[model samples]
Target: MTPKLVAGIEPPYYTAVFTSIRPDAPEGYAETASRMRRSVEEIPGYLGHESARTPGGIGITVAYFRDLESLDAWRLHTAHQEAKAYGREHWYDSYSVHIGRVERSYGHERA
Candidate 1:
């Protein structure tokens, strides 16, 4: 299946698109990931997010924040930092993070 392009916030917002390849059923990963997601939502300036993963364990998660500073805050969060370390040591085989500022946004929806 194809990955979906996340619908982002209004222009001038920031997004962090994280893509990762993981081992099959990595232990403790699901719990840690769920905790991290919930934790991020409570942070100031968090807008929203979209995430999906393939059957092959390739996944993409796009997290939106009000600005670069908010995004940086998440990146530096202690729990988040620990999760990143765990990903490097045990969960992910490879990963990539792309950050961008949305200049414009338009979409169509059927009623």
Candidate 2:
């Protein structure tokens, strides 16, 4: 599916990602991205997410969900948190997170 980012007037959600993985990681980058992508698909509120590797750093992603409750549930999930910890301790040199809500959204997909 080709997902497009539509304009939104909503509260707006914010996500901050910072990372510095060792050179060896770029070699296994596809595997790591696949793992993270699968993990996201398992979460309840999980709308979508992505990850990318670059010469300088890694790109992380997150997506919009139904509500804060769904978001919170994903947040508290044990495996999710474990993956986060793994990122902090081994995968990433540093990172950050900023959570919020969207105030509005406008767009539609035609099938």
Candidate 3:
């Protein structure tokens, strides 16, 4: 699927920025990732997300939520927690998660 920037999200929201490098032979990674993406959409305060991966295997996914509570919900989600454990054991070479609050934001697009 093509990656697109998430638009129309107002500020005072929270973002979970996940950055990672995949190990060689990441079996079941794509399917698990897709499932996680779908799973996040079902969570109550999910706003949106943007994700991309480079040819060299560096990847980043930024997920937006309406508040810290929503972010925590995602963190404790059973499926998401399982995915995280699987990633650590079999998929990722390295990864980091950074959570931040967006107080303001600005952007532009050409049509």
**What CA root-mean-square deviation does each model show from the true structure?**
3.1, 4.6, 1.5
lDDT by residue for model 3 over 1-111, one digit each (tens)? Answer: 644688878888999999999864478987888899899899899999988788888999899999998999999999999999988988888999999999998888877
Residue 29 lDDT, candidate 2, scale 0-100: 47
Candidate 2 lDDT by residue in tens digits, 14-110: 3323334544454444676577668756866556543455676655454555567667776787766777776666666656666756665567666
lDDT of model 3, residue 1:
61
Quote the lDDT for 44 in model 3: 94
> Using lDDT as the measure, which candidate wins?
3
Local accuracy of candidate 1 as per-residue lDDT tens digits, 1-111: 754554645778998999999976789988998999899988899998888799899999989899998999999999999999988999888999999998887886555
Ranking by lDDT: 3, 1, 2
Worst 10 residues of 2 by lDDT: 9-18
All candidates' lDDT scores? 0.89, 0.58, 0.89
Q: Candidate 1: misplaced stretches above 4 Å?
A: 1-8
Q: Show model 2 residue runs off by greater than 4 Å.
A: 1-32, 50-53, 106-111
Q: Would you estimate the TM-scores of all the predictions?
A: 0.89, 0.61, 0.93
